[model samples]
Target: MATNPPSIFSDSRRKANRLRTLSLQAGISAPARFVLDDMVDDMAERLAFVRHEPEKVLVIGDYTGRMADEVLPHTASINAADLVGKHAIDLSRPFPVTGFDFVGVLGLLDTVNDLPGALIHLRQALAPGGMVIAMFAGSGSLPALRKAIYAAEPDRPAARMHPLVDTRAAAELLQRAGWKDPVVDSHDLTVRYRSMDRLIADLREQGLGNVLASPAPPLTRVGLDRARQAFMAEADEDGRVTETFSILTLSGRRSLAGT
Candidate 1:
Protein backbone atom coordinates (compact mmCIF):
# COMPACT_ATOMS: atom_id res chain seq x y z
CA MET A 1 0.00 0.00 0.00
CA ALA A 2 1.09 3.52 -0.74
CA THR A 3 1.30 6.09 2.03
CA ASN A 4 0.01 9.56 1.42
CA PRO A 5 2.52 12.30 2.12
CA PRO A 6 1.37 15.28 4.10
CA SER A 7 0.79 18.46 2.07
CA ILE A 8 1.24 16.86 -1.35
CA PHE A 9 -1.15 19.30 -2.94
CA SER A 10 0.55 22.20 -1.17
CA ASP A 11 3.95 21.13 -2.45
CA SER A 12 2.66 20.88 -6.00
CA ARG A 13 0.93 24.24 -5.70
CA ARG A 14 4.15 25.86 -4.55
CA LYS A 15 6.08 24.41 -7.47
CA ALA A 16 3.46 25.62 -9.90
CA ASN A 17 3.63 29.12 -8.42
CA ARG A 18 7.40 29.21 -8.78
CA LEU A 19 7.19 28.11 -12.40
CA ARG A 20 4.56 30.72 -13.19
CA THR A 21 6.78 33.41 -11.74
CA LEU A 22 9.74 32.24 -13.78
CA SER A 23 7.63 32.10 -16.93
CA LEU A 24 6.58 35.72 -16.48
CA GLN A 25 10.20 36.74 -16.04
CA ALA A 26 11.16 34.82 -19.17
CA GLY A 27 8.42 36.29 -21.37
CA ILE A 28 6.81 33.21 -22.97
CA SER A 29 4.38 33.94 -25.78
CA ALA A 30 1.77 32.41 -28.11
CA PRO A 31 3.74 29.68 -29.91
CA ALA A 32 4.23 27.65 -26.74
CA ARG A 33 0.57 27.94 -25.84
CA PHE A 34 -0.40 26.77 -29.31
CA VAL A 35 1.55 23.52 -28.91
CA LEU A 36 -0.18 22.71 -25.64
CA ASP A 37 -3.56 23.57 -27.15
CA ASP A 38 -3.00 21.03 -29.90
CA MET A 39 -2.13 18.36 -27.37
CA VAL A 40 -5.37 19.01 -25.49
CA ASP A 41 -7.29 18.75 -28.72
CA ASP A 42 -5.87 15.28 -29.37
CA MET A 43 -6.64 14.19 -25.81
CA ALA A 44 -10.24 15.33 -26.14
CA GLU A 45 -10.61 13.28 -29.29
CA ARG A 46 -9.33 10.09 -27.63
CA LEU A 47 -11.48 10.53 -24.52
CA ALA A 48 -14.54 10.87 -26.71
CA PHE A 49 -13.89 7.42 -28.15
CA VAL A 50 -14.22 5.57 -24.84
CA ARG A 51 -17.49 3.67 -24.60
CA HIS A 52 -18.51 4.64 -21.10
CA GLU A 53 -19.80 8.14 -20.51
CA PRO A 54 -18.91 8.66 -16.88
CA GLU A 55 -21.34 10.81 -14.93
CA LYS A 56 -18.39 11.81 -12.77
CA VAL A 57 -14.92 11.97 -14.29
CA LEU A 58 -11.65 12.65 -12.59
CA VAL A 59 -8.76 14.25 -14.51
CA ILE A 60 -5.53 13.90 -12.59
CA GLY A 61 -2.89 16.54 -13.28
CA ASP A 62 -5.56 18.74 -14.82
CA TYR A 63 -3.25 21.79 -14.82
CA THR A 64 -4.75 25.10 -16.01
CA GLY A 65 -8.18 23.54 -16.55
CA ARG A 66 -7.37 23.16 -20.25
CA MET A 67 -8.25 19.50 -20.67
CA ALA A 68 -11.42 19.85 -18.62
CA ASP A 69 -12.83 22.44 -20.96
CA GLU A 70 -11.77 20.45 -24.01
CA VAL A 71 -13.46 17.34 -22.66
CA LEU A 72 -16.58 19.00 -21.23
CA PRO A 73 -18.21 19.85 -24.53
CA HIS A 74 -17.49 16.38 -25.87
CA THR A 75 -18.99 14.69 -22.82
CA ALA A 76 -21.94 17.06 -22.49
CA SER A 77 -24.57 14.45 -23.21
CA ILE A 78 -23.13 12.26 -20.43
CA ASN A 79 -23.23 15.00 -17.81
CA ALA A 80 -19.64 14.46 -16.80
CA ALA A 81 -18.26 16.24 -13.76
CA ASP A 82 -14.66 17.03 -12.75
CA LEU A 83 -13.71 15.78 -9.29
CA VAL A 84 -10.64 17.96 -8.67
CA GLY A 85 -12.52 21.16 -9.57
CA LYS A 86 -9.65 23.18 -11.08
CA HIS A 87 -7.23 21.76 -8.53
CA ALA A 88 -4.73 18.92 -8.87
CA ILE A 89 -5.22 15.79 -6.79
CA ASP A 90 -2.68 14.32 -4.36
CA LEU A 91 -1.85 11.05 -6.10
CA SER A 92 0.27 9.81 -3.20
CA ARG A 93 -2.95 9.79 -1.21
CA PRO A 94 -5.83 7.57 -2.19
CA PHE A 95 -8.33 9.49 -4.29
CA PRO A 96 -11.71 9.47 -2.55
CA VAL A 97 -13.78 8.36 -5.48
CA THR A 98 -16.00 5.48 -6.46
CA GLY A 99 -18.30 4.64 -9.37
CA PHE A 100 -16.66 6.98 -11.79
CA ASP A 101 -17.05 5.78 -15.35
CA PHE A 102 -13.93 7.48 -16.66
CA VAL A 103 -10.65 8.92 -15.41
CA GLY A 104 -8.28 10.88 -17.60
CA VAL A 105 -4.74 11.42 -16.45
CA LEU A 106 -2.74 13.80 -18.65
CA GLY A 107 0.98 14.47 -18.34
CA LEU A 108 0.97 13.09 -14.79
CA LEU A 109 2.26 9.52 -14.66
CA ASP A 110 5.71 10.46 -15.95
CA THR A 111 6.51 12.75 -13.05
CA VAL A 112 4.96 10.75 -10.20
CA ASN A 113 7.52 9.04 -7.98
CA ASP A 114 5.23 6.20 -7.03
CA LEU A 115 3.56 5.50 -10.34
CA PRO A 116 2.61 1.88 -9.60
CA GLY A 117 0.86 2.81 -6.39
CA ALA A 118 -0.90 5.71 -8.05
CA LEU A 119 -2.17 3.41 -10.80
CA ILE A 120 -3.48 1.03 -8.17
CA HIS A 121 -5.43 3.85 -6.59
CA LEU A 122 -6.86 4.85 -9.95
CA ARG A 123 -7.91 1.30 -10.68
CA GLN A 124 -9.63 0.97 -7.32
CA ALA A 125 -11.63 4.15 -7.82
CA LEU A 126 -13.29 3.21 -11.08
CA ALA A 127 -16.80 1.86 -11.56
CA PRO A 128 -17.29 -1.50 -13.28
CA GLY A 129 -15.94 -1.42 -16.82
CA GLY A 130 -14.71 2.09 -16.24
CA MET A 131 -11.93 3.26 -18.52
CA VAL A 132 -8.79 5.26 -17.84
CA ILE A 133 -6.86 7.38 -20.31
CA ALA A 134 -3.41 8.35 -19.14
CA MET A 135 -0.79 10.42 -20.92
CA PHE A 136 2.81 10.92 -19.87
CA ALA A 137 6.14 12.17 -21.16
CA GLY A 138 8.16 9.48 -22.89
CA SER A 139 11.88 8.74 -22.90
CA GLY A 140 12.42 10.56 -26.17
CA SER A 141 11.29 13.94 -24.93
CA LEU A 142 13.81 16.82 -24.83
CA PRO A 143 16.63 15.32 -26.84
CA ALA A 144 18.09 18.68 -27.79
CA LEU A 145 17.83 20.05 -24.28
CA ARG A 146 19.38 16.96 -22.82
CA LYS A 147 22.26 17.06 -25.24
CA ALA A 148 22.88 20.74 -24.64
CA ILE A 149 22.80 20.34 -20.88
CA TYR A 150 25.28 17.50 -21.11
CA ALA A 151 27.59 19.33 -23.49
CA ALA A 152 27.50 22.47 -21.34
CA GLU A 153 28.64 20.68 -18.19
CA PRO A 154 30.34 17.36 -18.72
CA ASP A 155 30.55 16.75 -14.96
CA ARG A 156 26.87 17.24 -14.27
CA PRO A 157 24.04 15.44 -16.04
CA ALA A 158 20.77 17.22 -16.35
CA ALA A 159 18.24 16.09 -13.77
CA ARG A 160 15.85 13.41 -14.94
CA MET A 161 12.97 15.58 -16.06
CA HIS A 162 10.28 12.92 -15.72
CA PRO A 163 10.03 9.26 -14.77
CA LEU A 164 9.48 8.60 -18.49
CA VAL A 165 6.91 5.84 -18.76
CA ASP A 166 7.67 3.70 -21.79
CA THR A 167 4.85 1.79 -23.48
CA ARG A 168 5.74 -1.62 -22.04
CA ALA A 169 6.14 -0.25 -18.53
CA ALA A 170 2.88 1.63 -18.75
CA ALA A 171 1.00 -1.46 -19.89
CA GLU A 172 2.42 -3.39 -16.98
CA LEU A 173 1.34 -0.68 -14.57
CA LEU A 174 -2.22 -0.94 -15.81
CA GLN A 175 -2.21 -4.71 -15.37
CA ARG A 176 -0.74 -4.38 -11.90
CA ALA A 177 -3.52 -1.94 -11.10
CA GLY A 178 -6.00 -4.66 -12.03
CA TRP A 179 -7.14 -3.24 -15.30
CA LYS A 180 -8.09 -5.22 -18.41
CA ASP A 181 -7.44 -4.70 -22.09
CA PRO A 182 -4.61 -2.33 -21.38
CA VAL A 183 -3.56 -0.42 -24.48
CA VAL A 184 -0.63 1.90 -24.95
CA ASP A 185 0.63 4.16 -27.74
CA SER A 186 2.80 7.20 -28.25
CA HIS A 187 2.93 10.40 -30.29
CA ASP A 188 5.48 13.13 -30.82
CA LEU A 189 5.12 16.90 -31.06
CA THR A 190 7.95 19.18 -32.07
CA VAL A 191 7.64 22.68 -30.70
CA ARG A 192 9.82 25.30 -32.34
CA TYR A 193 11.07 28.25 -30.30
CA ARG A 194 12.78 31.46 -31.26
CA SER A 195 15.30 31.20 -28.46
CA MET A 196 16.36 28.96 -25.59
CA ASP A 197 15.10 31.46 -23.02
CA ARG A 198 11.67 31.47 -24.62
CA LEU A 199 11.56 27.67 -24.56
CA ILE A 200 12.48 27.60 -20.87
CA ALA A 201 9.84 30.23 -20.23
CA ASP A 202 7.17 28.18 -21.94
CA LEU A 203 8.08 25.17 -19.82
CA ARG A 204 7.64 27.23 -16.67
CA GLU A 205 4.38 28.77 -17.76
CA GLN A 206 3.06 25.28 -18.50
CA GLY A 207 4.14 24.09 -15.03
CA LEU A 208 6.76 21.77 -16.48
CA GLY A 209 9.84 23.33 -14.94
CA ASN A 210 12.52 21.38 -13.03
CA VAL A 211 11.09 19.84 -9.85
CA LEU A 212 13.56 17.00 -9.52
CA ALA A 213 13.94 15.50 -6.05
CA SER A 214 17.55 16.57 -6.31
CA PRO A 215 18.23 19.11 -9.00
CA ALA A 216 21.64 20.29 -10.05
CA PRO A 217 23.00 23.52 -8.58
CA PRO A 218 21.84 26.70 -10.26
CA LEU A 219 23.51 27.35 -13.60
CA THR A 220 26.63 29.47 -13.36
CA ARG A 221 27.04 32.44 -15.69
CA VAL A 222 29.58 30.46 -17.76
CA GLY A 223 27.29 27.45 -17.88
CA LEU A 224 24.35 29.60 -18.93
CA ASP A 225 26.43 31.13 -21.72
CA ARG A 226 27.52 27.72 -22.97
CA ALA A 227 24.03 26.36 -22.79
CA ARG A 228 22.70 29.30 -24.73
CA GLN A 229 25.31 28.76 -27.39
CA ALA A 230 24.56 25.05 -27.58
CA PHE A 231 20.87 25.77 -27.98
CA MET A 232 21.54 28.28 -30.73
CA ALA A 233 23.82 25.85 -32.52
CA GLU A 234 20.86 23.53 -32.86
CA ALA A 235 18.63 26.25 -34.27
CA ASP A 236 17.67 26.12 -37.93
CA GLU A 237 18.02 28.84 -40.58
CA ASP A 238 14.65 30.14 -39.41
CA GLY A 239 16.20 31.08 -36.05
CA ARG A 240 14.11 28.48 -34.21
CA VAL A 241 15.12 25.35 -32.37
CA THR A 242 12.76 22.43 -31.90
CA GLU A 243 11.85 20.87 -28.58
CA THR A 244 10.48 17.37 -28.97
CA PHE A 245 7.81 16.16 -26.59
CA SER A 246 6.88 12.50 -26.66
CA ILE A 247 3.51 11.65 -25.16
CA LEU A 248 2.72 8.07 -24.22
CA THR A 249 -1.03 7.57 -24.18
CA LEU A 250 -2.45 4.53 -22.43
CA SER A 251 -5.95 3.18 -21.79
CA GLY A 252 -7.44 0.32 -19.81
CA ARG A 253 -10.66 -0.85 -18.21
CA ARG A 254 -11.56 -2.16 -14.77
CA SER A 255 -13.26 -5.54 -14.58
CA LEU A 256 -17.03 -5.19 -14.44
CA ALA A 257 -17.07 -7.22 -11.21
CA GLY A 258 -13.81 -8.29 -9.61
CA THR A 259 -10.96 -7.12 -7.40
Candidate 2:
Protein backbone atom coordinates (compact mmCIF):
# COMPACT_ATOMS: atom_id res chain seq x y z
CA MET A 1 0.00 0.00 0.00
CA ALA A 2 2.95 2.34 0.35
CA THR A 3 4.60 3.86 -2.74
CA ASN A 4 7.65 5.97 -3.60
CA PRO A 5 9.87 6.94 -6.50
CA PRO A 6 12.45 4.32 -7.43
CA SER A 7 16.08 4.76 -6.46
CA ILE A 8 18.86 4.55 -9.02
CA PHE A 9 20.65 1.83 -7.11
CA SER A 10 17.54 -0.36 -6.77
CA ASP A 11 16.60 -0.37 -10.43
CA SER A 12 17.02 -3.93 -11.65
CA ARG A 13 18.79 -2.96 -14.84
CA ARG A 14 21.22 -0.65 -13.11
CA LYS A 15 21.97 -3.15 -10.37
CA ALA A 16 22.56 -5.96 -12.84
CA ASN A 17 24.84 -3.72 -14.88
CA ARG A 18 26.76 -2.71 -11.79
CA LEU A 19 27.17 -6.32 -10.75
CA ARG A 20 28.32 -7.23 -14.22
CA THR A 21 30.94 -4.53 -14.15
CA LEU A 22 32.12 -5.52 -10.70
CA SER A 23 32.23 -9.13 -11.78
CA LEU A 24 34.52 -8.24 -14.64
CA GLN A 25 36.79 -6.13 -12.47
CA ALA A 26 37.13 -8.88 -9.93
CA GLY A 27 37.54 -11.47 -12.69
CA ILE A 28 38.20 -14.83 -11.04
CA SER A 29 39.90 -13.33 -7.98
CA ALA A 30 37.64 -10.43 -7.01
CA PRO A 31 37.00 -10.08 -3.27
CA ALA A 32 33.63 -8.41 -3.89
CA ARG A 33 32.32 -11.54 -5.59
CA PHE A 34 32.58 -13.49 -2.35
CA VAL A 35 29.98 -11.26 -0.77
CA LEU A 36 27.51 -12.33 -3.45
CA ASP A 37 28.45 -15.96 -2.93
CA ASP A 38 27.73 -15.62 0.78
CA MET A 39 24.34 -14.12 0.04
CA VAL A 40 23.49 -16.97 -2.32
CA ASP A 41 24.46 -19.57 0.24
CA ASP A 42 22.23 -17.94 2.83
CA MET A 43 19.30 -17.89 0.44
CA ALA A 44 19.76 -21.52 -0.53
CA GLU A 45 19.77 -22.56 3.11
CA ARG A 46 16.49 -20.73 3.73
CA LEU A 47 14.85 -22.15 0.64
CA ALA A 48 15.39 -25.65 1.97
CA PHE A 49 12.33 -25.31 4.23
CA VAL A 50 9.72 -24.85 1.55
CA ARG A 51 7.35 -27.82 1.33
CA HIS A 52 6.61 -27.46 -2.34
CA GLU A 53 9.01 -27.14 -5.22
CA PRO A 54 9.11 -23.56 -6.54
CA GLU A 55 8.45 -23.27 -10.23
CA LYS A 56 8.56 -19.51 -10.13
CA VAL A 57 10.80 -17.70 -7.67
CA LEU A 58 11.28 -14.07 -6.84
CA VAL A 59 14.43 -12.60 -5.39
CA ILE A 60 13.96 -9.10 -3.95
CA GLY A 61 17.46 -7.91 -3.22
CA ASP A 62 21.07 -7.78 -4.37
CA TYR A 63 21.92 -11.33 -5.41
CA THR A 64 19.44 -11.24 -8.34
CA GLY A 65 20.85 -13.01 -11.41
CA ARG A 66 23.79 -14.38 -9.48
CA MET A 67 21.63 -16.33 -7.00
CA ALA A 68 19.45 -17.88 -9.68
CA ASP A 69 22.46 -18.84 -11.71
CA GLU A 70 24.03 -20.53 -8.75
CA VAL A 71 20.89 -22.49 -7.87
CA LEU A 72 19.71 -23.18 -11.41
CA PRO A 73 22.78 -25.16 -12.30
CA HIS A 74 21.99 -27.54 -9.46
CA THR A 75 18.16 -27.51 -9.21
CA ALA A 76 15.63 -28.24 -11.92
CA SER A 77 12.35 -27.22 -10.22
CA ILE A 78 13.08 -23.53 -10.63
CA ASN A 79 11.52 -22.87 -14.02
CA ALA A 80 10.92 -19.11 -13.89
CA ALA A 81 12.74 -16.38 -12.00
CA ASP A 82 12.39 -12.64 -11.49
CA LEU A 83 14.58 -10.28 -9.53
CA VAL A 84 13.96 -6.80 -8.19
CA GLY A 85 17.55 -5.85 -7.51
CA LYS A 86 16.87 -2.76 -5.49
CA HIS A 87 16.05 -1.82 -1.93
CA ALA A 88 13.47 -4.31 -0.65
CA ILE A 89 11.60 -1.34 0.80
CA ASP A 90 11.23 0.82 -2.33
CA LEU A 91 10.25 -1.58 -5.07
CA SER A 92 9.46 0.36 -8.25
CA ARG A 93 6.30 -1.61 -8.83
CA PRO A 94 4.19 -4.21 -7.12
CA PHE A 95 5.72 -7.67 -7.55
CA PRO A 96 3.69 -9.02 -10.46
CA VAL A 97 3.57 -12.50 -9.06
CA THR A 98 1.24 -14.93 -7.42
CA GLY A 99 1.72 -18.41 -5.97
CA PHE A 100 5.47 -18.33 -6.12
CA ASP A 101 6.86 -21.22 -4.07
CA PHE A 102 9.55 -19.02 -2.57
CA VAL A 103 10.79 -15.45 -2.17
CA GLY A 104 14.22 -14.52 -0.91
CA VAL A 105 15.21 -11.11 0.46
CA LEU A 106 18.82 -10.84 1.55
CA GLY A 107 20.47 -7.80 3.17
CA LEU A 108 17.66 -5.46 2.21
CA LEU A 109 15.28 -4.57 5.07
CA ASP A 110 17.66 -2.20 6.87
CA THR A 111 18.20 0.11 3.93
CA VAL A 112 14.58 0.63 2.94
CA ASN A 113 12.52 3.63 4.04
CA ASP A 114 9.46 1.57 4.95
CA LEU A 115 10.08 -1.95 6.15
CA PRO A 116 6.49 -2.84 6.97
CA GLY A 117 5.13 -1.73 3.63
CA ALA A 118 7.73 -3.69 1.78
CA LEU A 119 6.94 -6.86 3.66
CA ILE A 120 3.26 -6.36 3.00
CA HIS A 121 3.93 -6.16 -0.70
CA LEU A 122 5.95 -9.32 -0.53
CA ARG A 123 3.12 -11.09 1.30
CA GLN A 124 0.58 -9.99 -1.28
CA ALA A 125 2.85 -11.16 -4.05
CA LEU A 126 3.06 -14.66 -2.61
CA ALA A 127 0.66 -17.41 -3.53
CA PRO A 128 -1.07 -19.32 -0.77
CA GLY A 129 1.48 -21.16 1.37
CA GLY A 130 4.42 -19.35 -0.17
CA MET A 131 7.57 -18.80 1.95
CA VAL A 132 9.92 -15.89 2.46
CA ILE A 133 13.45 -15.72 3.84
CA ALA A 134 15.20 -12.46 4.62
CA MET A 135 18.27 -11.23 6.45
CA PHE A 136 19.62 -7.89 7.70
CA ALA A 137 22.29 -6.37 9.91
CA GLY A 138 21.26 -6.02 13.57
CA SER A 139 21.66 -3.42 16.36
CA GLY A 140 24.53 -5.20 18.14
CA SER A 141 26.77 -4.82 15.11
CA LEU A 142 29.96 -2.76 15.44
CA PRO A 143 30.11 -2.40 19.23
CA ALA A 144 33.85 -1.78 19.35
CA LEU A 145 33.81 0.91 16.69
CA ARG A 146 30.72 2.38 18.23
CA LYS A 147 32.41 2.62 21.59
CA ALA A 148 35.53 4.14 20.13
CA ILE A 149 33.53 6.75 18.20
CA TYR A 150 31.39 7.56 21.23
CA ALA A 151 34.48 8.03 23.33
CA ALA A 152 35.87 10.37 20.72
CA GLU A 153 32.66 12.42 20.53
CA PRO A 154 30.29 11.64 23.36
CA ASP A 155 27.83 14.30 22.26
CA ARG A 156 27.26 12.79 18.84
CA PRO A 157 24.52 10.26 18.37
CA ALA A 158 25.57 6.64 17.94
CA ALA A 159 26.39 5.95 14.32
CA ARG A 160 24.99 2.85 12.69
CA MET A 161 27.90 1.71 10.54
CA HIS A 162 25.39 -0.71 9.03
CA PRO A 163 21.65 -0.25 9.25
CA LEU A 164 20.67 -2.96 11.71
CA VAL A 165 17.21 -4.35 12.40
CA ASP A 166 16.42 -5.40 15.95
CA THR A 167 15.42 -9.08 16.01
CA ARG A 168 12.18 -8.48 17.86
CA ALA A 169 11.37 -5.50 15.71
CA ALA A 170 11.86 -7.54 12.53
CA ALA A 171 9.66 -10.37 13.74
CA GLU A 172 6.95 -7.88 14.60
CA LEU A 173 7.28 -6.30 11.19
CA LEU A 174 6.83 -9.69 9.50
CA GLN A 175 3.63 -10.29 11.43
CA ARG A 176 2.38 -6.79 10.66
CA ALA A 177 3.19 -7.45 7.04
CA GLY A 178 0.81 -10.42 7.23
CA TRP A 179 3.34 -13.25 7.22
CA LYS A 180 2.38 -16.43 9.02
CA ASP A 181 4.61 -18.67 11.13
CA PRO A 182 7.47 -16.21 11.23
CA VAL A 183 10.80 -17.27 12.75
CA VAL A 184 13.79 -15.01 13.40
CA ASP A 185 17.37 -15.73 14.49
CA SER A 186 20.61 -13.80 14.83
CA HIS A 187 24.40 -14.36 14.84
CA ASP A 188 27.49 -12.20 15.16
CA LEU A 189 30.80 -12.13 13.28
CA THR A 190 33.72 -10.28 14.80
CA VAL A 191 36.44 -9.16 12.40
CA ARG A 192 39.79 -7.72 13.38
CA TYR A 193 41.53 -4.87 11.60
CA ARG A 194 45.05 -3.52 12.11
CA SER A 195 43.76 0.07 12.15
CA MET A 196 40.75 2.27 11.57
CA ASP A 197 41.94 2.99 8.04
CA ARG A 198 41.79 -0.70 7.17
CA LEU A 199 38.30 -0.93 8.63
CA ILE A 200 37.15 2.13 6.69
CA ALA A 201 38.51 0.69 3.46
CA ASP A 202 36.63 -2.58 4.00
CA LEU A 203 33.41 -0.68 4.62
CA ARG A 204 33.77 1.33 1.42
CA GLU A 205 34.62 -1.73 -0.65
CA GLN A 206 31.55 -3.49 0.69
CA GLY A 207 29.34 -0.46 -0.09
CA LEU A 208 28.44 -0.22 3.57
CA GLY A 209 29.32 3.44 4.02
CA ASN A 210 27.04 5.69 6.11
CA VAL A 211 23.81 6.69 4.39
CA LEU A 212 21.71 7.43 7.45
CA ALA A 213 19.07 10.10 7.51
CA SER A 214 20.74 13.37 8.52
CA PRO A 215 23.98 11.57 9.28
CA ALA A 216 26.74 13.50 10.99
CA PRO A 217 28.83 15.66 8.69
CA PRO A 218 31.82 14.05 7.02
CA LEU A 219 34.65 13.17 9.39
CA THR A 220 36.97 16.15 9.85
CA ARG A 221 40.74 15.74 9.94
CA VAL A 222 40.80 16.35 13.71
CA GLY A 223 37.90 14.00 14.26
CA LEU A 224 39.58 11.29 12.22
CA ASP A 225 42.78 11.74 14.21
CA ARG A 226 40.92 11.44 17.50
CA ALA A 227 38.95 8.44 16.28
CA ARG A 228 42.18 6.72 15.26
CA GLN A 229 43.61 7.38 18.71
CA ALA A 230 40.53 6.03 20.40
CA PHE A 231 40.51 2.96 18.23
CA MET A 232 44.18 2.32 18.96
CA ALA A 233 43.60 2.70 22.68
CA GLU A 234 40.89 0.04 22.55
CA ALA A 235 42.92 -2.35 20.43
CA ASP A 236 43.35 -5.90 21.69
CA GLU A 237 46.65 -7.33 23.01
CA ASP A 238 47.58 -8.20 19.44
CA GLY A 239 47.27 -4.51 18.49
CA ARG A 240 44.25 -5.10 16.26
CA VAL A 241 40.84 -3.42 16.50
CA THR A 242 37.70 -5.50 16.21
CA GLU A 243 34.34 -4.68 14.71
CA THR A 244 31.24 -6.82 15.18
CA PHE A 245 28.62 -7.59 12.54
CA SER A 246 25.36 -9.02 13.83
CA ILE A 247 23.24 -10.70 11.16
CA LEU A 248 19.52 -11.31 11.72
CA THR A 249 17.87 -13.96 9.58
CA LEU A 250 14.06 -14.17 9.35
CA SER A 251 11.68 -16.57 7.62
CA GLY A 252 7.92 -16.91 7.41
CA ARG A 253 5.13 -18.43 5.33
CA ARG A 254 1.91 -16.91 4.08
CA SER A 255 -1.09 -18.78 5.41
CA LEU A 256 -3.04 -20.92 2.95
CA ALA A 257 -5.99 -18.75 3.80
CA GLY A 258 -5.98 -15.21 5.20
CA THR A 259 -7.04 -14.86 8.85
Worst 10 residues of 2 by lDDT: 79-88
Taking every candidate in turn, the Cα RMSD to the unseen true structure, in Å, is 4.3, 4.8
Give the whole-model CA lDDT for all candidates, comma-separated: 0.67, 0.63
Tens-place lDDT per residue, model 2, 28-124, is 3444333335656766766654544566676655433665676533453343332322332344345655566677765655666566777887777
Off by over 4 Å in 1: 1-31, 34-36, 64-70, 73-88, 158-163
After superposing all C-alphas onto the true structure, candidate 2 shows an RMSD in angstroms of 4.8
Query: Which TM-score value belongs to model 2?
Result: 0.76
Model 1, C-alpha of 247: deviation from truth (Å): 0.8
* Candidate 2 wrongly placed segments (more than 4 Å): 1-29, 32-37, 49-52, 63-66, 72-89, 156-163
TM-score of each: 0.81, 0.76
